[model samples]
Target: MKLYTHPDCEKHEMPGHPERPDRLRAVMQRLSESGMLDDINVELAEEISDETLAMVHPPDYIEAIKAAEPEEGLINVDPDTYMNNGSTRAAKLAAGACLQAVQDVLCGEEKRVFCATRPPGHHAELASAMGFCLFNNIAMAADYALRDERINRVAIVDFDVHHCNGTVDIFKERPEVMVCSSFQDNYYPNRYLDYTNEHMINLPMAPGSKGGEWRKRVEREWLGKLEDYKPDLLLISAGFDAHKDDPLAQIEFDESDYEWITQQLLNIAEKHCAARLISTMEGGYDLNALADCAEQHVRALI
Candidate 1:
């Protein structure tokens, strides 16, 4: 497994925000302290070009995001999304890191890759930014893989506490991509598209739901769908906020649960795509829990 990270990812920040730089900092520090950092291949992320950003975002939307960057202080792009001086670059790098992860895994440089960049991108739409996300990183990576990697299909499995409304918006109609998202139903960003489309599998869990329910849903819903699709690549919207210890949502998952889920996904990956997988960080507010749970997720990958 390869781990892609960048210090600049911590530059996109707002004061006292739940989605702040300290989250990634804590994750990295904990990985180092736990000696997990020494076990995997670590690579610094490269800056993404405008052409790459255009793969998913339109020119106008990209320009608007760049124009929103403040010269000094913070500027609000949405009610929750904000941009500082370093935000635009950080957002590009975050998205680019996902692309790099895909390139590494598909070209046989690594069988699996985990991106630890920040400014979680699942909630950012094609034309707009939301939920503290500026650019839809995972969606862009999926697009890149299909277009450039000579892969027929890709499966995106999102376990964020909140729904990946942006990613669904991007590929809802594309049959070549299958997106399975399990989020707390009627929670933040409550408005969601109907899951009538064959490619979209939305698993809505209620508050207080435990890992047993999540595991059952994966076994019952995801495994069969994935078997039918037989995707060439497995992309994960890896969010740790579903943990019981996280303050963002009320889903009860422990570090072991993350490990278990990763193993389950790896089983499907091994059967379908020779274990080609790439995961990018999403939402995880509680630092301690995020660090510990992310470690376990990576441990499973190795």
Candidate 2:
């Protein structure tokens, strides 16, 4: 697996926020200390174009965010989202990292890629910004895969503790994209993924559910639909916030659970496609657990 990250990723932040710079720094440092970072290729991602981001987000919304980048201090865009001077570059670079990862996989340069940048982007809606996300990186990456690369079917599996309301909203009406999200029900950004098109699958787990419960739903729902869709590529909104130690959610998931799910997705990818997978950072608040668990998740990609 190839890796893409940027220093600007740390530049976007809010004081005492959960989505802080240390999240990326922790993961990167752990991967390095684990020796996994040395075993793979690394690339510094560039900025994605406005048009590429606009593929999923509206133009006015894009301009609003770009225009919101403050010259001095932090600007609160929403209850959860904030922008410092470096936010615009950070968000663009995050999206660009996913773009490069997808292109790399489709071009056969790598079997898979993990995008390790911030701020997490699952809760961001198409025309709205919330949940510490400025843009829909994974959704835009999927759109980039479909429109520019001509990939027919792509399955986005969001394993975050929160529902990917943004991704679902973007692809709810389009059959070409299939989105399966496992989130904590009755939580912030409550489940709203609904459409008769049969393109979106939103599974909200109970607050106290553990890995055992998660496995059942994925086995019964996600794997079956993914196999049926026969996606040309697999993209993961890989959020480790479901870990037991995360403060944002109450679900209990260990690193073994993350490894298990990654293997399951890899199996489907190997069976249907050429083992091409692109995953981006979404959520994982606990520094220690997030770092350790993310290390295990990336190990599966290798």
Candidate 3:
């Protein structure tokens, strides 16, 4: 497995915020402590080009975001999202890491990849940012893969505690890409509840639900959908916030849940896509919980 990340992500964080840089720090520290970091191939993230970002975000919106970056204090992009001096670059690099992961896996450079990036992108929309996100990294990566003539289909599975409203919004009308997201029903950015699309699988887990509920739902819903889709590559919007120890959400999943889901995904990927899989970071607030869950997930990946 190949790991893509950057320390610059820590430069763009909000002070005392749940989505602070320490989240990635904890993840890396734990991976190192567990001896997983040294065993894997670690690469520095590259900044995505404007053309690549424009594939998901509008040109004007991109320009506006670049202009919105503050030199000194923090700037609020939404009710819960903020930007510091390094936010724009961090967001771009996060998305870039996903894009590079896709290309690397598809070209056989690596069969499996884990992107430990920040400012989780699942909530960022085509023209706006929200839920502590800027650019939709997984969405853009999926878009980039679909743009390649050699790749016909891709599957994106999001196990974040919150719904990946941005991803759903981007590909709701597109049938070539299959998007399956399992999130807490009563959580943030509650739009698209009424959406009904053949290619989109939205599983809303009730708050306080445990791993058994999640596992059952994935086997019943996601597995069937993935079997039918038969994607050329698998992408994951991995969020450890569902762990029982998380402070931002009510879901009660633990590290074991992360390992279980990863194993299931790996099985599917190996069967259909030559084991090509890329898992990207999304949400997870509790430092200890995030580190532990990330370690288990990476252990499963390797």
The per-model lDDT (C-alpha) reads: 0.90, 0.89, 0.91
lDDT of 3 at 275: 93
Pull out the clashing pairs in model 2. none
Query: Given candidate 1, what's the lDDT at residue 205?
Result: 90
> 1 or 2: which has the higher lDDT?
1
CA deviation > 4 Å runs, candidate 2: 148-150, 191-197
- In Å, residue 228's CA in model 3 sits off its true spot by 1.2
TM-score for all models, in order of appearance: 0.98, 0.97, 0.98
Rank by lDDT, highest first: 3, 1, 2
Best by TM-score: 3
Per-residue lDDT value at 115 in model 3: 95
lDDT score for candidate 3 against the true structure: 0.91
How far in Å is the alpha carbon of 36 misplaced in model 1? 1.7
Model 2 C-alpha RMSD to native: 1.3
Candidates arranged by TM-score, highest first: 3, 1, 2
- lDDT tens string, model 2, 1-302? 79999988999978898999999999999999999988889899899999888778889999999998999999899987899999999999998999999889888899889999998787788898888988889988888888755589989999999889888877888888899999888887864833324668877898889999899989997888899999988999999999999999999988899999999999988987789899899999999999978988999989
On a 0 to 100 scale, what is the lDDT of residue 76 in model 1? 92
Cα RMSD to native, each candidate?
Answer: 1.0, 1.3, 0.9
